[model samples]
Target: MHIAEGFLPPAHAVAWGVASAPFVVHGVRSLTREVREHPESTLLLGASGAFTFVLSALKLPSVTGSCSHPTGTGLGAILFRPPIMAVLGTITLLFQALLLAHGGLTTLGANVFSMAIVGPWAGYAVYKLLRRSNVPLMVTVFFAAFVADLSTYCVTSVQLALAFPDPGSGFLGALGKFGSIFAVTQIPLAVSEGLLTVLVMRLLVQSSKGELTRLGVLVAQKQARTGTETEAVGR
Candidate 1:
């Protein structure tokens, strides 16, 4: 959910911008390291960024007051890591803001914070945790993407609630109202995005195997498969 241009008060906008600056810097550094260490990863990184850009630009109807869309950073984060996702997400958001006028320059920091930094990292954490616990790959990816998409809207709702509190119930009440509206529309969309991300990952496993192999997904997936086969044989 984009907060739209000039919607936030000056203080909130500036504060968000200040808050996001460090993450953006670190993202740039992470991207630099990835390219430097695994030059072949450049293609995968670009492709991940493109995936984020395309999915994010498709803004759905606002079931509530604000428009909703898939952050798409979850897939990027899982593939390229959260630090790289911050850079890619910013670039995608900036592209839409400048070209399509979908979002806005004024609210870029807030959008990036939610879509790029917050959601992606949260999703990545979920993915890593699930992977460590021996979860199925598809299930892990589904939850990662699902959490990432939902978390972005959750953060956006909080941001909006903070700025525009309910006249009677104050921030807490506003938070509740905004969160409810978001949940209704965004829940289904989050599930859809999660499935789509896994589908895309499957496609990449075939079409972009080399690039993904460079990133260790192919090897990990192979190990998982072998382990499953061994367990079945023992059974």
Candidate 2:
């Protein structure tokens, strides 16, 4: 749901620009800590990001002519952390704009806000929350990704309503339209995202034990001063 320039009035775009700026700055700072925490997973993150970029570009319609795609940041966040996904999110958006012209340059911040910040963090929170108990990994992943996708569309709808406030539109009116636009598309897409995330995580676990360990997913046997020990101490 990448918003094009001039889709909203000048006043609205400017307002969203203002609202989106802080998230971009917060996201940048958060990413640095993530890199420091999981130094060896750079390659994995990059690969995941490339997949995400491609996934997001695969457009399908939500409301007839109006199209949308999976953000994929939710999966990244669940596998790693939300902060690392933020970097992936920004890169995906930038590449989509520059390489594919899928989204506009001027509305880049708005895109970042909707897809990167909202999607990843929301999904991560849901995953972590659901995983607190003994819930099935697949089930948690499905719910987390579903909520994340739903959240992105909700945010997009809100921003659009703010930008293009109909003279007669109130909060309920906005909610109704937003619900109508996203409800159908998000459901199947969320299920797909969850399954894909689980499969990718499974692959990483099988292929590179070292990388997952470095990224802090696997907990190996404790040695007094090994990587695991050091990470535990750091934490």
Candidate 3:
């Protein structure tokens, strides 16, 4: 999801930085709270971040003549929450840039804003809105991933427009091009990502019933056991 260096103007870069600062701060704060409240969540966050870093680097064909990859922010948001996922995503992006040069340093903030901030938040909102037990989790994952991927592309187009405000290269034109490009590629990618996320979630739910408990998604017997242990120790 890197916009490639020089695609965006300096003004656009600065503008995105300014716009994303508050969200980044919020994400950090949320991550901190989650870690403190449920230390095991950090393990899942790190695992997911590592997987995202690896998964997103795999190239797939795109109509725009550039390769695209799954952002995986939607999966993170669905499993955790958007703000915490944003922080985890930023960390993963940082590692990708440093280790693989998948993205440039100059455009890192813009990339994070588009993929981590926009994608995760939008996906989480959609998933929450459409996802009742009545709906299949896999179906919800597909729709959320689809919307999230498209939303990231839309944010990237706007970021590019901010950088290139030439009359012929207006934001609308940028948006139109992005809409077409994503329409061609995002569906397949979204379906793959959604299926993968659901599969992983199913495995996790089965193997680690205490996990969502650690996330405060539910109370598990482990908590009761821990409490009993604490009382025994106290007595």
Report the C-alpha lDDT of model 2 over 149-187, residue by residue, as the tens digit.
778877877777766555686766776686677756676
Question: What TM-score should be assigned to candidate 2?
Answer: 0.82
**TM-score of predicted model 3?**
0.82
lDDT of 3 by residue, 51-100 (tens): 57766876776655756788877778877778877887788778777787
> Which 10 successive residues of model 2 have the least lDDT summed?
216-225
TM-scores across all candidates?
0.88, 0.82, 0.82
Tens-digit per-residue lDDT, 28-120, candidate 1: 998998899878888888888888877886767655565567878888888887988999989888888888787688899898889889999
Model 2 ranges off by over 4 Å: 33-38, 61-67, 214-235
Best by TM-score: 1
Check candidate 1 and list the clashing pairs.
none
- Number of the predicted model whose lDDT against the real structure is largest: 1
222 Cα displacement, candidate 2 (Å)? 7.7
Of candidate 3, the 10-residue stretch with the lowest lDDT total is 213-222
RMSD of 3: 5.7
Query: For each candidate, what is the lDDT?
Result: 0.84, 0.72, 0.72
